[model samples]
Target: MTRSTPHVVGRLSFDPYEGPAGGWGSLSGMAKVVLRSGDLPVDQLMRQNKPGGFMCVSCAWAKPAEPHPAEFCENGAKATIWDLTPRRAGPDFFASHTLTELRTWTDYELEQAGRLTDPLRYDAASDRYVPCDWAEAFAAIGGRLREIDPRAAVFYASGRASLETSYAYALMARMYGSQNLPDSSNMCHESTSVGLTQSIGAPVGTVTLDDFAKTDFLFFFGQNVGSNSPRMLHDLQKAVRRGAQIVTFNPLKERGLEAFTNPQSPFQMLSPATTEISAQYHQVKTGGDLAAITGLCKWLIEADEMARAAGNPALIDHAFIADYTEGYAAFADFCRGADWGEIERESGLSVAAIAQAAAAYARSTAAIGVYGMGLTQQRFGVSNVNMVCNLMMLRGNVGREGAGLCPVRGHSNVQGQRTVGITEKPELAPLDVLKDQYGFEPPRYEGMTTVDVCERVLERQVRAFIGLGGNFLRAAPDSPRLEAAWGSIDLTVQIATKLNRGHLFTGRAAYLLPTLSRIERDVQDGRPQTVSMEDSTSCIHASDGTREPASPNLRSEMAIVAGIAQALLPPNPRLDWGAWRDDYGKVRDAIAQTYPDKFADFNARFRQPGGFHRGNPARERDFSGMEGGRARFILPPGLSAVGFDDAPDVFRLMTLRSNDQFNTTVYGYHDRFRGIQGTRDVLLICAADMDRLGLEAGQVVALETVSDDGIDRRKDGLRVTPFDIPPGCLGAYYPECNVLAPVGHHAQDAKTPAVKGIPVRVRP
Candidate 1:
């Protein structure tokens, strides 16, 4: 229906953007999305993130209590317009293009083809997808699902699904007697959850949006605020204007963390002036956040002894450590005993750089630590979180008025889905309440994670896959392997808003069901339905649509989940699938019953303008939920930043999202911030590394993953570009470069694919 931004081989532009993160640059990008999509998004854009309006369906960044008139960002606009486009892939479109021909298209091309208008089933003889009646499609899928062992089925959830839909989906999975409910979290913040839970007895972050007001010092690690969450630039600008300190640690010196020009401000937009963001920026090596943080802890502990002996103010919170934490002795001893040489080497920073940050931490009255996927998608991702927790707790940041740890989550409502029982771990869910309410025993056994699903698919153990959302094959590691394994499944169902490459990776019996986006009105039984979302800050708010559906035949996610469940399972009086699908209040009521403490009066609380915070115990310094009833100081695993082989010839390649991309969804071909265009297949390597590898700039190069595992993961035709990254580090766009990250070589504890620090060798 429409052409996407073409991906073609071209000379790369490395002109550094001179302006701030958001200005006319961002506005122009948003305007382009509107013009190209043949859709007018101004009305919907005005309502996004407003009071009683639909939440932005892009990032999970929290909405402020007093939001700006335009609370959405450039990427948010792109996501909305990307969904609201007039292009439709109806029966005619499918008839014109065979499945084999569709498979040859790029991810951008496939998405640009348009949104699916009706339920479709894969036909073997025709080698294409044909429109089918909703009932017939559901019955066929249900019959196939019933034939398979439920345990062999994987129920995947994406972050775009509202809490109500995720709740119903979770119930369906449990009713089907399976707990393989792995969502997008497994690829990104799973390490945050696992590490935070082990250290502080809570899986969620402790910091709230208001903490920015009182925080004088902010420590940002592995997160590009400008690109990842541009709305965060507003808070950074506020903090800067108030003379607060923002110190950033990242491999790349992102423009957003450095400076910002708020698009909402007419004066700034008209002028050349921009607000400076970070007071100090440290370019740490890829996978070196652990060592960098450990160095901070080491410096503080070493300075504490000096201060105490000199009768100066103590550097660390000694009283808090003694009274509210355990294992401080072992943790402190380990840090003090750490070698300065190793810390400097592993962190890719000198002792002076580490000491400067430690000094700022020591002097700060209150501070906050913000991180993202960069810290979590590592070999020792859990350890990375524990170290961040250790650094924050050393200053008593946890439970403080203006200080805590904030993991900036990606994708809207990812955190909310986990809260509402879309999880592989049964212990995390209120299984007893689910049993009492639903009249079924919730699956107790631990289910397969994302990595486990990919691995099992090869062995044919996972026979069926029902994805609520997300491009699993593309987002996952070992793309070629997963894409090949995709067809081996017996049944695969995707409830999506638009076309993605994931739809083409069909199984023997596959169905693509178009669903209403969160921004579209869902009328059930003549009643306009509403749903809820939980932001990264744990603020639960209602998100309902005023815009009509893209297609008349499109169904709501809850309805699709219910349809499948009704066809597969026997009738049960306790579970009211029909009401939950239509009313949505019934779903929220059920969620409230499951987590009464958190979701009490779920329907009422979420109606508030800013919504209600789902209280976190860790913020209150309540460690009773953890072992030994106290926050524990976790010891560092090793002196090395990456807890893997340190081969000299191997380069550390970190997968990244382009400025115009989100996760696996490539919106365009250009990463404007990095000065690249018309392609996503460029490798960013430092000058020193380029010299060592004897590679010329703009030369197409290939990369082979260096792993002990027998599986050889490789990618070719990447144009090498010299960059300002750490000497041994390189950067490449994800999903395109996701091929180099082999399965099973992931964060074993969190099961997150180590996309950030993949060891690779480059060849021309």
Candidate 2:
């Protein structure tokens, strides 16, 4: 074995693994064993017979299969291991440790203690939390709310919350005359929602997983399936087996996307078997997705014009454009006028390469375009999505069997919670339906978004915060600012399954209430209960965890929300909280009645094997916009107006996820894709950049983040590792780097921080 010196930074170290012997020849042999052994628990989660089934709550990707006896992914295993760990943060633990001492603990150390046991209050005299009764906690919270201005209160929700819990929480905040409702979506897919809604009349993806299996071509933009959404690899593998051309456009060459071995396939482990996913891979610059996509559209139009002159059929879908789309001429004109030099410079893709991709797209009968945070966390995030929609519109891809748009969503029920009305800005139709069904007037004023809540707290407007499930303080951009904002709040309430960084950042009076994990059985009203999750493919299914609750005292998120509402609300004339709490079925009934067009017989339909898929306007080719057509192409202003201009010696830093971790939480330090092991403190740099800077592959360096507002946020002790990446670009892990992002530096329309693409200068 040829042992190489691994990179080291801070308290972490990275050691590369030498898989077997030979080069590409040995890859097939290694894959065979990986498939047979199914080393990763993620593959097992997708099989049927398992308690939780194949659905991943961490990332909403599901498929129909028998649940394996031991099912979970690396990240899922991390989530389960963390959840099932025999660690407890009880009243005795709190008594032994002061708030000051606990604050000094790392996020990993604090959560290692397991689950929270009882409600506790922070005593300023002793600077420690003491056990308090549930009633006292509620009353104290209510009293604080009554004392503060209504607008001064902020209620935040994490993606772990179920649809029922989210609805109740949203209702509680609105009824209390406050719109300070910040949610997890603000940091992730808010741009997808905003852009798709404006351009396509809906905020969700147009394609289903079935489409992936049937499509002739698959185009991935700014997404890493291996770490961000591993289940997606199964679909990609299927597509590759069917001879579908798979193309990937990302800043890094993700290993999972390059090749994958299906652990479920019996022959995979026994023989030299693996799927080659990316037929063509392009390493686009950070924040350059919009330009790359636009260039593809431009090439498509040019090809169509050329084909038309040859007396052959036009490359563009004229029938679909005429019958279903609007504003085609304007978009085509914009594409015609675009400069190739500008596109090449910004996207870091040669004109010939983009033209080849465009030709492939035009030749294919059906194609699907998928993207993730790389496109959404940029200055013109919404606009980038619009550009993608426009490309699909040009080819009449929407509402087709094998073609449409797919915004790979993060979190299991993030999209489901939004569908059930966890939004800060609820539509008029949903609000009206909710009021009519519940017999209460819903608030008319627009509620606070994630950014709004942070601003409110900074202005001393928000006094109290109640989180359903998430690490908000750590996940949100600008940790220092968020930490100070938390201090300004009078009371903080956290209803969580496990310990996270958010719990350590306490307010004057705080309570850490433990809740049942998603993988644990939830018993309500003397019966086991199962909650529904909506996957990225628009499929809604029931998830029942086999594991027992962490503790008897730990309640479901629904129960906790109900308890708080029952404690705080006056004897209400409308809105029956008691009926909803007795059984979750009542809440489903209300949902069915409110959204009859989509969620009819909500409870009954969810009992099906794979559940039911929601109505997809694009799948049906029913473009229900102002144009009264299918889908139309809308021209974006241009790439010139997108993102910040680079300065001398400044490289755009893009935050990424390791294979062993999820958002905000670090499971392990290893990143298997880049050959990194046992450490996340390494920075991926282009070889050219390292040579230019006179730096070696494993050199220790300090990363200084320069915010748009001229603030200097620095993270020291990052080992630089040279990799295959575009010049003028750098890569690092997130949350730890989230502090370097400016609080105010967000997408123009969506307000999502550009965490994936931030311009910065590195110091030695």
Number of the top lDDT candidate: 1
Q: What is candidate 1's lDDT per residue for 1-764, written digit by digit as tens?
A: 11122248345465666667889889877776677688877899988888778998899898877889899988988988998889998999999998889888888888888888989999989989999999998899889989999899999999999998898898899999999999999989999999999999989999888898889999999998877888888888998899889989999988898888889998998888899999889999998887788889999998999999999989899888987899999999999888889888888999999999889888998999899889899888888889999999998999988899999999899999999999999889889988888788888999999999999997878899999989998898888887887888999998888888788888889999999988899899999988889999999988879888889999998899999999999999988778778888888888888898999998878888778998999899889987789998998688544556667788888988888877777777667788787788788999998888788987888888888878877787787788889998999888888888888778758989989988899876
Candidate 1 worst ten-residue window by lDDT: 1-10
lDDT of 1 at 46: 89
- What are the root-mean-square deviations of the candidates from the true structure over C-alphas? 2.2, 4.6
Could you give me the TM-score of model 2 versus the true structure? Answer: 0.92
Residue 570, candidate 1: how far off, in angstroms? 0.9
Q: Report residue 207 deviation for candidate 1 (angstroms).
A: 1.2
Query: Which residue pairs clash within candidate 1?
Result: none
lDDT of each: 0.87, 0.74
Deviation in Å, model 2, residue 636 alpha carbon: 2.3
